[model samples]
Target chain A: GAGVSQSPSNKVTEKGKDVELRCDPISGHTALYWYRQSLGQGLEFLIYFQGNSAPDKSGLPSDRFSAERTGGSVSTLTIQRTQQEDSAVYLCASSSRGGVGADTQYFGPGTRLTVL
Target chain B: AQSVTQLDSQVPVFEEAPVELRCNYSSSVSVYLFWYVQYPNQGLQLLLKYLSGSTLVKGINGFEAEFNKSQTSFHLRKPSVHISDTAEYFCAVSAPGNTGFQKLVFGTGTRLLVSP
Candidate 1:
């Protein structure tokens, strides 16, 4: 079976530019999430989608960060006016659940975004 | 809010040596614990999880983790590791049920280097 996957394995962009990272979760996964990993830093929570809805956006670092999941299948993380601080590996994950304990979340390869 | 800490950034070991990666998490509510492995150029793979029941959980590749509620720790240990075991390990925590919505708070990660 296909596992979670992400696009643009690596991305290089100028500061202040915008970038959109895509993720395709495992088939039938109803929950999608985004996270950031910076050098020497732990994985930072971003945002998540359950089914076609989003109940938690608190992890989003700033107003420029946003994410959406449509049809309860795929998800996209859009970083507006990207900054050097936003340079990191953007990882996506999905789960076969609407609730947490119902299923385990699977991760994707991740899109590495480098903002100059 | 929840946070995770991995005390070690890197651990180099000879093949067949025993290894331990420490992880600590802080949260106000009861949470589900997980350990994930990431090989080079790949996404995270679930190694093990502790939702309920036994405190000691076994996972693939001869890996195991002990969940200490009093210590709020989920430490990964592997005895007699293999060269193939070289990779990055991440510890994560998430609240259970709908509030979890698959959201995870992850540790910085511990890189395991198993050499022959």
Candidate 2:
């Protein structure tokens, strides 16, 4: 079976521009998550989506960061007015189900975003 | 809220030597624990997890972790390591979210430098 996958393996953008990162979770995965990995911040959770439930936006760093999962499979993380500080590896993951501690979340090759 | 700490930023070992990466977490409620490995230029991969039952959990690539409730620690250990084991290891914790689903928190990460 195909594992989780992300598009645009690498993206470089001007500081003030906007960028979108996409994620395709494994088949039948009902839960998806977004995280950011940077040298200064390590790994930080950004957002989460569960089937039909309102997305958890608490982890989002700011209003500039937002995400949406359409048709319960593909997810897109959009960053508006990007800053140099936004440079990092954006990772996506999915699980068979949400709210269960025992469920395993599989990850995808992250999209590295560089803001200059 | 939950937080994870990987005190050792780096661990170096000779091939076939035993190694341990320490991890500690803080949370008010019961949480699930996990260890993940990330090879250079690759996505994060699950090494092991501890949700319930036995504290000793085994994972892929001859790695294992012991979940110690009293110490609030889940340390990864391997009896012997190979040069191929060089990578970054992450420790994570998850607890119920506001919506009653699990949300994960991750540690800074420990870089394992295995040399022949």
Candidate 3:
């Protein structure tokens, strides 16, 4: 079976430009999440979507960061007016279900976003 | 809010030797614990998880972890490791009651280097 997948394995853009990262969750996975991993740092939660319910945006670092999952499968994280601080490996993950103890999340290879 | 701490930034050991990566978490509520491994140029993979029941949880690639509630720790241990075991390890925690989403808080990863 195919695991979660992300597009544009690497992206380099201007600091003021906007970038959109895409994620395709494993088929039938109802919960999806996005995270950021800076060099030599931990994975920072960004946002999450569970079924048709409201997406959990608490972990989003700022208003410039936003994500939307359409049809409960594919998700896109868009960063508006990217800053050099937004340079990092953007990772996406998905699980069969939602909730704290429901299932283990499988991760994608990630898209390395570099703001120059 | 929950947070995770990986005590060691890096651990180097000879092939076939025992190794341990320490992880501690802080949260006011009960949480689910997980260990993820990331090989170079690859995505993160689930090594193991501890949701409930037995304290010892076994994971892929001969890795295991023990959850200690009193110590607030979930350290990963492998009796014998291969050169392939050289990679990054991350510890994460997810608390309940988060609007049906399991948002993870991750620790700064520990880089494992196995030498012959």
Candidate 2 is scored at a TM of: 0.97
Model 1: per-residue lDDT, tens digit, A4-110? 98998999999999898999989988778887888856687677787878787777889999888888887888999999989899888888774665367888999
| Candidate 3 residue lDDT tens string, A1-116 | 49999999999999899999999999999888888999855688777788755457887899998888889889999999999999999999988986646479899999999999
DockQ of each: 0.59, 0.74, 0.66
| Best by the DockQ measure | 2
Fraction of native contacts (fnat) of each candidate: 0.66, 0.66, 0.68
**Which portions of model 2 show Cα errors greater than 4 Å?**
none
Cα deviation of A75, candidate 2, in Å: 0.7
Q: TM per model?
A: 0.92, 0.97, 0.95
Each prediction's number of clashing residue pairs: 0, 2, 0
Clashes of 1: 0
**Cα lDDT tens digits for candidate 1, B1-116:** 67889999999999988999999999888888999999997888999999899999999878999999999999999889999999999998875424546467778898999999
Model 2 Cα lDDT, one tens digit per residue, B12-112: 99999999999999999888999999999889999999989999999999999999999999999999999999999999998777667677789999999
Q: On TM-score, who's better, 1 or 2?
A: 2
Residue A47 in model 2: shift from native, Å?
0.7
Full candidate order by lDDT, most accurate first? 2, 3, 1
Return the TM-score for candidate 1, rounded to 2 decimals: 0.92
Clashing pairs in 2: A99-B101, A99-B102
